[model samples]
Target: MKVVIVGGGKTMFFLGRNFAAKGYRVVIINRNMEECEDLAKQLKAVVIFGDGSNAGTLEDAGTASADAVLAITPHDQDNLVICQLAVNRFRVPRAIALANDPDNVKVFEKLGIQAFSTTHIVSSLIEQRATFEEITNLMPLGEGKVNITELVIGSGSPVAGKQLKDICLPDNSLIAVIIRNNQSIVPRGPNELHLNDRVVVITLPENHGKVLKMLTGEE
Candidate 1:
């Protein structure tokens, strides 16, 4: 996957290094030449020094064929604009914008862009660190009105034999994907579950218990 990032902050460095290590082509954009050079050198990613909100800059950064685009600039408005161009004009398959304020997510989602609420995730993690073994919390999207939780199939799960269509899954939740041998399978309603398969589910936090039970066959 080729990923284009419209930011040069710590987040970009973290993401760039990870994707590059995994053999994906990553390009990071920023207006500051110094930051660009530093980030590029450190992460071994291509750095394009230009305005991230500019369509021309995105074109030069190859947004037209980008597999995914991230609008993670510090300014929320700039991130929104960049995301709009990537999603609406460029039509990148995955257009995610970093939402600094939880309140602003609705506007971005109205434009049909996926958004990340860093504020809520960080806070929730810090608060839950003492209690949960490992937390996979989904941030609110569309608006700051909903949240999702994901859990994987544990060892010896009883749900493995049943097809999704056969199992009476949670009404408020959906089976998102199944991973086997580290390969992701986006789940379909008729998909069959296999033993030892890892699953990632997207469901409201209120429905987490039901989804977990459906996945692990444990209440």
Candidate 2:
């Protein structure tokens, strides 16, 4: 996969390195020459010095064939423009933007751009930790109609030691993956739910509560 990242800060640095390390062709487009030079030296990906929001700069950065484009600049407007150009003009398959202000997420969403806000994500993490002990992660998808959630199996849970096929998951939900002892497994019907294992599931919004109850056996 080819990924084009627009920005020069910490987000770009980490994402460039991680994606490059994963063998994906990565490219970074930044406005600052010094930051671009620094990133070029530090990361294995290509670093281009230009304004990412500019269509010509993106064209020079090879955004036309990019599998995904991430507009992660601190300025929300710049990110929006970059993502819009990538998705609408360049026809990139995935266009993601970073919302520096949590309040900008709605605008990005309204514009049909995938937005990731660190501030909102961190706040959600803290809130989820406080409110739901069983749910470790909650990613809402399709305008919150569906969710991808992670549930940690407890020792006293009724589903523990039971085969996945034997457990009746809520409608429109299924176990997608299992993380056991740091190993990720594509769960199968014969797989058994073990204590301390983290189970990731794709479930509908209305069924989310039921999924939690079914797994943890707690209200």
Question: Top TM-score: which candidate number?
Answer: 2
- Per-residue alpha-carbon lDDT of model 2 for 1-219, expressed as tens digits? 999999877868998999999999999999899998899989998889999999999998899999999998889999999999999899999998999998888889998998878886676556545656788788877745677989899975789999999998877899999999899999899999899999998987567667777888776
What lDDT does candidate 1 reach at residue 196?
66
lDDT of 1 at 63: 92
Off by over 4 Å in 2: 130-171, 174-210, 217-219
| TM-scores of the candidates in the order shown | 0.65, 0.71
Q: Give lDDT per model, in order.
A: 0.76, 0.88
- Per-model RMSD to reference: 6.8, 4.6
What tens-digit string does per-residue lDDT give for candidate 1 at 82-167?
A: 98898888989988899888877776777777787888667655643333333355455444444454455555466777788887
Q: Clashes in each model (backbone N, CA, C under 3 Å)? A: 0, 0
* Per-residue error (Å), model 1, residue 58: 0.6
Q: What's the residue-level lDDT of 157 in candidate 2?
A: 79
TM-score of 1: 0.65
Worst 10 residues of 2 by lDDT: 123-132
Tell me the spans in candidate 1 whose CA falls farther than 4 Å from its real position.
131-203, 208-219
Please provide the root mean square deviation of candidate 2 (C-alpha atoms, Å).
Answer: 4.6
